[model samples]
Target: MPDSNTKDQIIKSMLNTAFYKSAGETSLANIAEGVNIKKASIYNHFNSREHLIEETCRSCKEYIEQISFIPSDIDSVSKKYPAETVLKGIVDRYFKMHEKQPLIQIYTFIQSQKYFTPEVMDIIQAQKTALISQTEKVLLSLIQNEKINLDSNDVHSTAMWFCSAINDMLSNYLLERKKDMLPFPEKNADKMANAKSDDAAIEKINAYIEKFAELLK
Candidate 1:
């Protein structure tokens, strides 16, 4: 039987491979070579390549949830903080979560495979649904606390709009980062420019959050 450590190594290799290539390219031999084990050793933990791929996807989803800022005690937080404070706190944590390199890798891998893989698509949909639902719950909590004066009827719509706007901003920021990674002769110059760009992007996002919070008041 494969030990837990061995199983974990396999999963890590799978994630790394899938992030750089596609899930379809993550063959058993590649995973085995990554972990420095025989190709057949993988079978002790996973039934087949497909089973390993599924498990890797499951692990990625769980890892994302672990690092995400899904509040467990929304009521208490809503009661403690003002609407602006609450929204800004969430946005700050959201930015921190995206800063994680492993999270970015897993997210990119899942996004690339989502179209061809039904399970990957489901994971993407679930993440979207969860974000919107959580935002709505927070809005409802703030409404109940009399922190914000938004119409109760518009709570869900407001949550959807807020989440969509945040997502778009994040996507654009990531695209700029991707562009920075392209091969170029002036690597140092590009790095400096990208650093400045990153700072400006973050400032823009912060300003958006502040404006959004002000609008809620």
Candidate 2:
């Protein structure tokens, strides 16, 4: 068995592979090879392929938490824009994070709940809970500010729609990126072709959010 430091290095190396490689390209054998270790060595650290993927994903979640964008304050959002615009901005920030971190790939798992073990599913659920709570807080602020009618079903539906729309659009966008297709052509074609910089995802997501926000009216 590898020492603790070596095991840590192996985990990091595996996660790095998951981050850079296409989602379809990542597997346990691939991770083992990248770390110059055998499959048994990998098993020594993790219980199964699903567990390994979960660990890699856990690393990704941490990386995302460290580097991801935080949505601007609700007060600032209300002061600067309408309630619908504020909600869109919040969802857009989430979309941007998912786009830039395709290797993280947890959002789609949260949306689909397939291809992940129950434990990994739990982790993703926790993340989603945090996201929804944040969104709810923003919506509540809008209601308080009188930017949205608190008792109106329209406002409630709008908030729910905002979350679903962003996830649906961004997940489809990432799947297309994996397939090298022009899912958001005209705006995303160049970025898809290049596929190297993180900024491409950021630009497209922000633009999509801006457009989707306008559509909320």
Candidate 3:
């Protein structure tokens, strides 16, 4: 059996290649070359390329969950920190998640493949639902603590709106990154020059989150 370190290397190799290559284009040979391991060695860790890809998708999901700001006990967190502080921290965590290039690459890759891959589609849907649910939980906690003035009746809808808005921001952020990755002709120099800097995009997201918190106050 391959050791844990070897297994991790394989997964890392998959993540590194995911952004620039399609699922079918990511062959075992490419993966093995990335890890400087023989192709046969991969079989010990994963039965096949499909298995490896599935595992990689699973790994990405787990990583996202790990980085996401989903407090296990929302009530406790609301009591410990002011509502604005909690909301700002959540936004900061999201920025950090986007800052991780590998995570962004994996997310982009998963999104691209979701249409053709059932597993990827499931991951996408699951994450979306989880994000909305977690946001609702946080909002409910804040309402219960009298930290925010949102109507309890509107918590679910508000959470959906919040998640949808954040998702749109993240999509635009990804589009900016995609533009950086793709080749652009000199004719598009003006457009490229007009593209927002990563810092600017992040600041915009922060401003939105602050506005959201203020509205709830």
Best by TM-score: 1
Q: Could you give candidate 3's per-residue lDDT for residues 1-217 as a string of tens digits? A: 5698999889888766655565667788878888899989999999888888888888878876665566566688898888878877776666456644567667877887787778888788888888888888889889889889998899999999998998888888877766675454323535434445578887888888888989998
Off by over 4 Å in 3: 2-4, 22-24, 65-67, 70-85, 175-197
Give a tens-digit lDDT track for model 1, residues 143-182: 8998888998998899989999988887788667645543
List TM-scores for all candidates, in order: 0.78, 0.61, 0.76
Which model is ahead, 1 or 3, in terms of lDDT? Answer: 3
Q: Give the clashing residue pairs of candidate 3, or none.
A: none
Report how far off residue 4 is in candidate 2 (Å): 5.4
* Residue range 20-80, candidate 2, lDDT tens digits: 4544566777767767888678777888866665665665467545543335566777767
Candidate with best lDDT: 3
Please list all clashing residue pairs in model 2, or write none if there are none. Answer: none
How much lDDT does candidate 2 score? 0.57
lDDT, model 2, position 28:
71
TM-score, ranked from best to worst:
1, 3, 2
Candidate 2 TM-score, true structure as reference: 0.61
lDDT value, residue 178 of candidate 1: 46
